[model samples]
Target: MKRFITGQHVSLWRLTKRVTAQNPMMKYLIKKIPPYPTPVEFWVSNVAHVTDETGFKGILKSEQFRAPKSELSWWDLKIKKEEIRAAEKNYMKRNFSNKAKEPNEQKPFLETFTTSPLFQLKKSRYGNYRFTFPLAELMEWYKEQNCGGKEPVLRVYGTVTYKQQIVYTVLIHSPEDSERFGEYPLLEASEWVRYQDGKIIWKAQAICETHRYQFVSGEVQRLKTHLFYVWDQVSLVFHLPNRTKPCKAVKIPRQRLIEALEACKLDRKIDLLRYKSPKNKEERFFEAKMKVSELKRELEEEVKEEKSEAENDIKMEVDP
Candidate 1:
């Protein structure tokens, strides 16, 4: 009888365990606990109890805490649904708010322009000149052509102006070769303009002789008048009327005139060139002319000095 009674007690304990496992409330409680040890289950149970007593289904689903479905009444479930909707709306609002700022953000213009296909084409078409012969070959050819056997050192000074504004200036030096016939360094100048479509495009190109030539070994003869123009398969000469012959002066483009003005400023002192007699027009003109004459004289002196210095440098290099 004692053994039977012990068996019955054990059976009763097993039945109770099974019933608890099946109970919805117990299962919900277990579900509320995270895989890791956390306070989420305790908080959910407290919220569920409060919501049940207050008859507020919405309170259970509030951002403060979320109750298990088995513990929440029908009304509390409705509140949870509303909370989910509100959270979704808030997320959407945040996402859209971030997107709105992008249009106003500054972007890199140069990087985009350089990557564009049109820009690439423009660069390829005008950026470099194709020469048939190499410099060494050109030098040999010059020797064979009886071109004075003087090695020519060409110095090219380039200035680019756009819309009456000086944009760029560069000095390129190339030593002439006599080996290759008709071989010269390719010269290319390109100007970029931005379009309404946010695309950067090339506007115009002005090419000129790069002043690089091959001469035979002998006296270095400077070309009498260096040619300046836009050359590509054809040459367009830029004519500057003699400043001394004002009446015969060709209309100077505004861009060229501006460059000339800038050059003049750098050529001489500004204060000495300014007119002091503002009250008398004739006197101002006369004074201005005299100032110009003085500036000219100074320029000539400076040129002479430069020439002398260059000669001295060459002498030193040769002597040393």
Candidate 2:
């Protein structure tokens, strides 16, 4: 016999099925989506929170719905185990590849000294300067001098250059060594005694004159003077080193030219955006006008609200 089911009947069937799906026995029988493939992304992303294969296995084994080990075939267990191992390997590779690439053994300090620079003082074309000195050197020097125990660190004398201005700086290096290095040299002390107390408290031996080199600058300052003094003793003098040699002119390299071109292109793009065509300029002006108009409207609304609030207060007072 031919029997046709109405739409109402079909709806009722679906409703009944949905209601029965809530039943504990039906829950297991209802075909569930096969467990989603364990995402490779899960191993790498939010690494601090993700569980390892052992932890995951423990979770699966603890689940109430999981089948018993005995129920599963040996091949299934082997496959799952292999999958877990593969996942672990992927996790290890992702996390440890960089670590593996890192140098495990460091070369000796003396070996490194020949290869690496102890200090670097770089001056750029724009008059910016950068200086790098090893902190370990100062500590090592202090240790060698025995500044910590018995012996003190006296006045520290070091040459410091600021923007190509070389100054023979004498500072109280350490309280321990202060008395030793602070003592003025015999010649300077005699000169200081001859001069008035306030007239010359500190005598600085100037090897280079201020007004000597008016036109030359930077490393070229070396050309202005041929005489070099060490502790008031003439160490180098008399002979001119490069009297006939011409000064080298600064040339922009090809790479610098390419970089400049790129910079020019970017500046041109910005200029075009700001003032390319009358239409774009007009559009910008229109946007600015709209913003101003909006601000004016907001201010007017605020004023009206304030007036209304005052009126309301007055009305309330009158009613009272």
Model 2: worst 10 consecutive residues (lDDT sum) = 231-240
lDDT of 1 by residue, 257-308 (tens): 2222111111111122232333443343344345445545666777799999
lDDT of 2 by residue, 97-197 (tens): 54322222311111111110111111111111111112232223333333442322222133322221222222213344345445523223232111122
The list of candidate 2 runs beyond 4 A from truth reads 1-279
Candidate 1 global CA lDDT score: 0.24
For this target, which candidate reaches the highest TM-score against the unseen true structure?
Answer: 1
lDDT of 2: 0.25
List candidate 1 stretches off by more than 4 Å.
1-278
